[model samples]
Target: MGLRQDLRRGIRLVKDVMRNRKAQGKLAEALAAQPPLEPHHYRVGVYFADGKVNLYQMRQWYKPLAELSKRHPVLVLSRASGAALAMLRESPLPVAYVRRVVDLERVIHEQDLHVVFYVNQNAKNFQMMRYGRRWHVFINHGESDKMYMTTNQFKAYDYALIAGDAARARLEKVLWDYDFDKRAIPIGRPQADHYSGTLPYTPDERTVVLYAPTWEGDRGAAAYGSIASHGVALVTALLATGRHRVVYRPHPRSGVVDHEYGVANRAIIDAIAAVNAADPGARHVYDDGPELGWQLSAADVAIVDISAMVYDRLAAGKPLLITRPANPAAVIDTSGYLGACEWLNAAPDPATGADAGASMLARVSEVAEDPEARARLGYWVERYFGDTTPGATTARFHDAIDHLMAEWERFAALHADDEEVDDHDEEGEADEDELG
Candidate 1:
């Protein structure tokens, strides 16, 4: 890793330490004052809520559980995810919001939860599920190629939901080798169900092209160009059409803590801001989460680099485009400085379009207007969504939560009301807030 990457990892580690310390302290106090009861008979707690819609693939797996709420009182866990879920509830579904993982655990024990479901497990999320909750269910985030994932991911849920047979096969192939066969369920993405149901009150009318770039990393947008370069090279050509709405959606990590200034790289973010403000057809949308159906609804096609938006766009079977640079040997990464646009489509560069001003509009326009080209893209979407049965696959994702809830019950039965002394080896104050 580069120095900046090393520093970033260090900073994240420091934050993790602080989180655990605070939660541990609270756990001790709660143990000392709680009642002992068998957890086999407890409520179920589901940890999820909606994120932004433009980010399609990453909605916290809450919508499907909407079905589960009819049978039981479901506890929805989140930080600001609650706000996103308000509209989703539509005046139904008994929901409780716990802002942190520690809060979830405490609530799980107190409520005697029978199962706990976790969807979208990234590196940090994996660390959050170590509570030995009796049964854990997982709804996986899929990959581009339907193949086995690295074993460290969340295949350990009592069951899992996959988008389709291909997704199931891919998930099973990767996980069973690690003995997670008994813990997976092949199902579809529930959020996909979300879009079909209701249209928001005031939807943007123009062909909304959601331009979401991944965060800065070894191979992310920050390396290529600031918001300006991407805007000029990719977004601008389309905006010049004066008939499209280009939504500049950056990765969820593009927050104040990520960049030096709250704004993205000055050159690029400034360009995007200017373009968005200047053109009625373009505007940048900041994320609260990766829930992006509203934006996706407005889109005729989604243009992305190596972001999940590509796969999510396929969920809608909408037209999608991925950018590739003309040159293969023009990529770079530095310690703290933003890198260069090295993330090119490695295939021999296509001569159909140019990355400069006018050429982009021509090539993209041809693709947008061509029904055959779009059909080819739809084929790609089918390959990605893989799930033929939506309800079944959604259950697979919820299965994990049920198991986790069950585990919480067993844990409460075993570790009720007991005191333990501290054996700390760190010196930072508690930061339990970030767990959401």
Candidate 2:
């Protein structure tokens, strides 16, 4: 039995390697025929290495990154050709596919990039860190209490554009001697300010409930995803309330780690379909699209897992319910938002013995009219995201980038000779050597 399991694991690894090779090969062909990057001194760059695996991360920055591009020459520098093509194909942001380290070296020297922003903690990013006279910033995909948020990896980046004070506190507790003021900049949630996309259903009077759960995590501590445990039951209860419009948006990579979880996810989606088919006016939606804003902005109340979706809905200042992870090993940080959050536990909690269905319906009914419940949302919103008025968060985001650019200019001037000349000069020499 162990031998069979090992064989299966080996087969999956081989398939993954083959897919990567194919993607790289296709990328090489495209790179050979592709045009030179749009000639401009890119002040800011978004560094991405993973192809398709972390595509959702890029989508989070799409609107805000595009807006930044208009002011400064913002370019998406992808280490994988396939990643570049994917971004260019789906998003309008200009992308440069750099398979070779020297190619990236040329971009840094030629563009005179002042700052480079990273979406995820990809190990390949360390290659870019070797370059000097530029600031390396970590702008994570979203705000969450998941272990990834408090990783030692945060120490590597020169700066991090965090959502608010909650992130600073989380990092301080985990990392010793970490400079929160200098290293962390509170930009709020820029995506919250740019939430767009048309609502699937018309806004007559139905209350929209968005069930956005995280993917089944890769390991035990991170296994905060509640799709298999709470999804079917919670979604069923919401749909049974005929007046509610259910917008089911599972994490893009949901069930990738667990087969049983995947099966359960499909079951929930099918259940929504069945409901829609039986009642055309139900307006039940199973959202798996690239768009994110519409659901958050449109939904009257949201039910989400203990991931980035939690803070995202909090930024919306709307009523929300967080699912208590069925896995006992999953870590729940109760310092800030999660402490104040209402939980929907499948198993009876000592304090709230009500089952998941009863708890969900009761909260939904209460939030619809309770002014104090809505006011409580406001207090948490201020704590997680300060000053969430129209355009406020986006302004702070731009200001943070501007601050980095200004600081880079001063630092670059003072340390002009610190810039690496060997890599850039070698690239030019190599071209001449080829010509000779």
Candidate 3:
């Protein structure tokens, strides 16, 4: 058994190496075909080091970054070949493939990068943060109440563009002696302003339900995934109801840590396919596409776990249900919106022996029609995102960037006479292979 496992691992490793090499070739060819980026053209830089697997982190920002580029030219400095290749094909903004430390330095030297944005807390982000004179800002992928939202890693950046009052309050409770007024800027959810993606199905009388669950976490504390516990049952119940259309968008990293979780996720997807086959007009979608906005906006009700999806749906200010984690060990932070939000449990009813799906249907119906629930949701929306008025968040986002740009100029003039220092030491540089 050990021998077989080792052989399988070796084969998988070989396949990964071959795939990466192919992607790198494609990236090189693509770059060679395009016009070389002009020197000092971009003022704003988005540094992403994660590969294709985590592209969702970057995909959500496409529209906002494209819009931001209109005023201040934006560039994406991709550190992974696969990510660079993918972004080069689809990203609205120009992409610079900086796979090695030396390549990264070249982009830094060329671009007048006044503000650099980070989407996630990828360890490789530190590689980009080491440079001085530019604002290393953390504009995270999404807004959420997960423990990840309050990590001490926030202190590492020059500033964090947070969501709103709730995020500030949440950070204050945990991060000690942090200068919130100076370091944290609330721009609301700028992505919310530009919710892209067209509707896959036409408008109908059927209630649309978007069930976007997070991945099975790497640890028990973060085990908020409901795909294994609540997903199959709830999705099944919704499909059985001819009046409902289920839009299942599971996290991109779903089931990476657990086999059973992957099985359940597949089951939900298969059920959607089968239901659609049986009724072509049902239009129950199993969306794994890069676009995210339409599902959030079109769905009559959304069911999400304890991850960023909860906050993403909340930003829509629509009626939604938060799936209660089946894992008792799963940590729940109720200090913010979770404390007062509606919850959907996986437990079955003793009287009816009904599964999670049946209960979910009832909950979905209740939330969809409840005026009181809508009112409550409205309050939380304002608390987390400030003004959901169209273009409001986008304006705030641009304002924040303008503020940082002005500050950069102020500091630049203050130390104009100081000797220029080269922070990129040869000893500190990692090998090209080490970057991946």
* Position 161, candidate 2: lDDT: 92
Candidate that beats the other on TM-score, 2 or 3, i.e. the better one? 3
How does each model score on lDDT? Answer: 0.49, 0.81, 0.89
lDDT of 2 by residue, 1-436 (tens): 6787578678877887777777666666766776776555678888887767568889889998888878777888887655666676677677776666777777776686788999999877887877777899999999988889999999999999998978888888999888888989998999988888887887868888889999989988889888899888778788888888889999977876786788889998999999999999888999988878989988888889999999888888877888889999998899878887877676533467777776766766776667777788888888878889989998998898888888988877788786455544343323210000
Residue 347 lDDT in model 3? 76
Return the number of clashes found in candidate 1. Answer: 36
TM-scores for the candidates: 0.62, 0.89, 0.96
Deviation (Å) of 303 in candidate 2: 0.4
Candidate 3 per-residue lDDT, tens place, 185-292, comes to 999998887765789999899999999999999998999999998899899999998999999999988876676788899999999999999999999999999887
| Stretches of model 3 off by over 4 angstroms after superposition | 1-11, 427-430, 433-436
User: In candidate 1, what are the lDDT values of residues 290-392, reduced to their tens digit?
Assistant: 3556656566766665444555666666666665532234242221111221122323225754445566555556656778756665444555455534564
Cα error of candidate 2 at position 204, Å = 2.9
> Which candidate model has the greater lDDT, 1 or 2?
2
Cα deviation of 268 in candidate 2 (Å)? Answer: 1.1
**In terms of TM-score, how similar is model 3 to the real structure?**
0.96
